[model samples]
Target chain A: MRVLGIDPGLTRCGVGVVDVEPNRTAKLVDVVVLRSPADLDTPNRLVRIADGLEAIIDEHRPQAVALERVFARSDVSTIMGTAQISGVAMLLAARRRLPVALHTPSEVKAAITGYGRADKAQVGAMVARILGLEAVPKPADAADALALAICHAWRTGGVAGAAVTDASAPAPLARTTTPAQQAWLAAERSAAVSGAARRLKK
Target chain B: MRVLGIDPGLTRCGVGVVDVEPNRTAKLVDVVVLRSPADLDTPNRLVRIADGLEAIIDEHRPQAVALERVFARSDVSTIMGTAQISGVAMLLAARRRLPVALHTPSEVKAAITGYGRADKAQVGAMVARILGLEAVPKPADAADALALAICHAWRTGGVAGAAVTDASAPAPLARTTTPAQQAWLAAERSAAVSGAARRLKK
Candidate 1:
């Protein structure tokens, strides 16, 4: 399954695309930060951002979009910009008949780092490890976008029975898990056990 | 000059179009409230609002757009929705090459009612009177949208040198006031004097 993740902002919007396999591995397709100058009027700035987003969508053609859910913050102006760009992203997705899924910051962090309160560096490290990247994507927004994409893919059980797959593909197993799924579950369990051991040692 | 005013909201967006003359008189062209169901997802609801706005613009062919500026308030969610829709409005206007002017709530009130703190009823009454309508536009949003359009027209000195007018039209005078401009200024001064007199009496 191909997922496009967006961390929306007026001045800097982060976009990342990833292809995920049913085996819970992800491959980086593209990642970039879209920026608009501050001196420009709000309307024109939005047009710039919208154009960048449209270009990315047209080039990548992802099956789904994962957007960061905006929340009220201390900086009112910043939050307003975030919300505005997020709305634009969702509108673009809807126009293309693509499904949009909103994920909270903490949800992405937890999905990537196995801890809801994980710091940015931790999430970035996990994302690099998951995608087999040489370095964490530059700029926090880029890494965050990648994390969102990985989170969505993992949460949706990767590409099993996804639309992009063959129509004759069997439905996702209910009681029985595929070998890859079992391995993934076992890896998670091992990680949890090691985390508990570290806490005990502390 | 034809102006399209938008009082943007996610659930019910108010839109009004008016034709304004250099004499400070305005005739209502169209006014309607575009609604999207709350039950619908945000993306779909936004798409619906965008479609409605596009249809109105196509039909009216307004020369400019006047949108209410969003501000932070106690209701964070409401403010977010307002900002989002406002962004959409601006983007639409930009795409059509129509200049967008944003007016704060107090500015709209002051322009329409000669008082910055006028209540909704007072503003609505002024809008209806200015448009020569028998009744105030239904729903506060509709009235507010018209007020925005009228305010923009009045602030920009109406249609004297507007693009919709003939290119050979004379430029707006600086020192020498036109008869209509003088009358409009006199009316504003009279309103100010009366307001002060009333305050003194109180």
Candidate 2:
């Protein structure tokens, strides 16, 4: 199933799509960041965001869309704009009859990094490693969107995939490797970096 | 000019419409309450609100729409839901290209009651008097919506139809009797009350 995950914001709404096969491996389909500047009037900006989502849905045709369910937030400043973007995502998805799943931020972190408390750096590294990409996605919002896609795939992927297991835990512990693994890891890094550059060009 | 005012909410969205002629005296056109039950999910509720707004626009064909500008409140509980509804209202208005105007709560209060901090009772009484209606519009949200409409008309309307002038401010202060005040006031109360009851039935 192909899933589209959106990290919604008024100025920078990020979208990332991933295809998760029966075997539980996920392939990065595409990622983009859309912006509606603060200076623009609210209605105009909202319409732009909705139009952008329409294009993304038409281009990607994801079977499902995952959004960060808006929570009651004490920080009123960012929540309004964020919720507005989130509202657009929800309305459009419903209009298209696409099944919608809402995941909390902690759920996303746990799914991506096996630690609900994982920081942005940890989530970014895991998104890169799991997707076999060269470097982390640029602009934190993009990485976050990709992370959301990966999270959905892992959480719903059945026995072959899991949300977060203690075994796959934090990255610092994953660093300990055998001598044979050390050399293999170095080679894999160089190949993946070059391959990522070539793939990104497309 | 005809104006539609929206008091946005998740479960209950209130709508009111009024027409102001060249002389500035306003007449109530219609009022309605739209619902998306709490038992229902978020997206479905949002669509219901949008559909209700569409119907209102089609039936009334208001020249302009007024919305309660979403505010940042310390209370986080209902703000997200309220803001989402507000966002939906804005988007629909934009889609129809019906000139959207947002008024803050205090601004609406001040326009109608001549005091930005006027309590609900004062606003309700003033709305009924200003629009030539009988009784307060039920469900505070609906009354609030009507108040919003009156605010827009008075604030932007040409000199003749002002809701309440700063000089003649406050319900009690504006209660001065003209030559025909006693008989006219009595007739107006009886006639308007019965007329309102029949209008509401339809």
Candidate 3:
């Protein structure tokens, strides 16, 4: 499944697209940082960002969108703009009939770096390593967007697989699983184990 | 000049339209509150509000939009939704090539009532009186929306007239005003004075 991730803002909005496989591997499709001038009024700035997002969604045609949920920060001024752009992003996704999932910053960091308190550099490094890129995506927001996409894909059970895997708890068995689904889950578990081993080795 | 005023929210968005003349008289064009169900997801709720706002703008064809500016409040949860809807309103206005102006709650209140910190009932009473309505618009948001429209119209000078008038200082002479513009400004000043006198009598 192709997932589009967005780190929304007024001045700079980062967008990344990735395809996740049933075995829990992710490949980068595209990444971009859309920007609007600071001197422009809020309305025009919103329009520019909205247009950029629309173009990206049309070009990639991602099945789902993963957005960075905005929180009210100490910086009251910037938070409003962040929330505004996020709204625009969500509206665009709804217009195209794509499902949207919002992931908090800490959630994205923990998913990518195994620590919710990890710094930007650690998350960026992990994102680069996961996508097998030679260098981390620039501007921090770009790497964050990619991490959001990977996190959503993994949390939702790889491409089309079912049931979230909790490290501390056994899988719930209320619903029956087909043989094909079981096999896919097994493959996913193995892949996760091997991926952790490789990271430990590095 | 026709102005559409919006009190944006995810659950209930208030919209009001009015036409203001050169003499600062405002006539109600239309007023309504758009609502989305609380059970709906954030994305769909946003879509519903956007559609409602778009339809109103298309139908009214207002020359300017006056949206209530959202502020960070003690209630953090509601602020995000307010900011989001405000963004949508601004975007809609921009798409139609109409100028959008954001007025704070105090600004709207002060514009309608003489006191900046006037309570809701006071502002509502003033809005009804200004528009010559029989009663205050129901659901405070509706009256607030009309207040926003009247405020914008008055602040910008009635029906596309001249520079902003200051109660504390003389009008800036930076730009030359035509004879017709001067006449409009004089009429606006007299209307403001008479309006204040009427309110004082009440």
Candidate 4:
């Protein structure tokens, strides 16, 4: 199966596609970086990234899409840009009906280098070796994308768990809940939101 | 001019459209809340939101889109969901070539209630009065969306600064920089990202 992995960001988004076999071996199919200059307005920058992903999807046609999960920023400043990019990436995958997975930074490191705490160089070298590349991918972000794809492939074994990954793809979210249970949960959320909004008014 | 204002959240996204006359009198056009269950998987919930926003835009045919600017969450957990929803809303506006604005909560409060730190009830009540409604919109989130639209209309004086906002719309994030300076700043960002990525791997 083929997987497209995205390390999403506002100024720079790293994307890589990989082909994985049942034996768990993975090969890098393609790698590219999507960058929107900081001077660009937010909407246009997001559009550029979304458009870039569309081109990649059309070109590689990966069976699944994976992304680096959004993490908290050290400051309040960087959160929106990261989340916006992450949101756009998920939307793109859903639009194409492709399954999506989100891996934490440590998840990528652990999958690629066998250590969740591995530094960037260690992860890069491991990703290079696993993909049978002569050198680590240029631009560490791109290598990180490759690491994410490899991680998703190794963790899910590709193809089989894709439906679970894409909550929009007719798979159960929690797997254990019945439709009735889900309906109850929905009602609970509605009540909670209304309650929260009401309380805030006081 | 008509404005579609979005109060973005993963659990409940509030959207409202309003018409602003030349004299700055505003009339309500439409209001609705798009809700996703907590039990729903993330991607599917996002798709539900993106689809809902698309329908709202097509139906209302608003000339501009506005939303509450992403703010730092006290709890941290809510930031990604809010930012992602915000991103999708902006992407929808960009796709349709509509101008978009982001109003801070305090700005909305100030616009509607004559006080920057006014509570939600005060803003909602003022929104009803401004739009000439008998009562505030049902479901506080929807009221909040209207407040956002009203804020944008009042602050930018409707269609006059739209071209500026939209240019800032397609491109800007920080919302404070001029275009030329933003471009130079973007170059600096490019250098910084490359530098940061390189250093991480070393």
Fraction of native A-B contacts kept, per candidate: 0.63, 0.43, 0.67, 0.72
lDDT of each: 0.78, 0.71, 0.78, 0.76
What local lDDT does model 1 show for residue A125?
74
| Interface root mean square deviation per prediction | 10.5, 9.7, 7.8, 3.6
Across residues B1-202, which tens digit of lDDT does each residue of candidate 1 receive? Answer: 8999999999899999999987777999999999998767777888999999999999999988888877788987788788888888888888888887777788688777777787898888778878999999999999999999988787667752232211112322223345766577557646744773234334
The local lDDT score (0 to 100) that residue B33 gets in candidate 4 is 96
The TM-scores, one per candidate, come to: 0.84, 0.77, 0.84, 0.81
lDDT of 1 by residue, A78-190 (tens): 88788888888888888898877777788687667767677787777777878999998989999999988887777666642232211112321222345666566557646
- Error (Å) of candidate 4 at residue A164 is 3.4
**Candidate 2 lDDT, tens digit per residue, B27-71?**
999999888877565776777888898999999998778888777
Better of 1 and 2 by TM-score: 1
Give the DockQ-based CAPRI class for model 4.
Answer: acceptable
TM-score of chain A of each: 0.82, 0.76, 0.81, 0.80
Candidate 3 interface RMSD to the true structure: 7.8
Per-residue error at B199 for model 1, in Å?
A: 14
Q: Model 3 chain A — which ten-residue stretch has the worst lDDT?
A: A164-173
Candidate number with greatest TM-score: 3
Query: DockQ scores for all the models shown?
Result: 0.32, 0.21, 0.38, 0.32
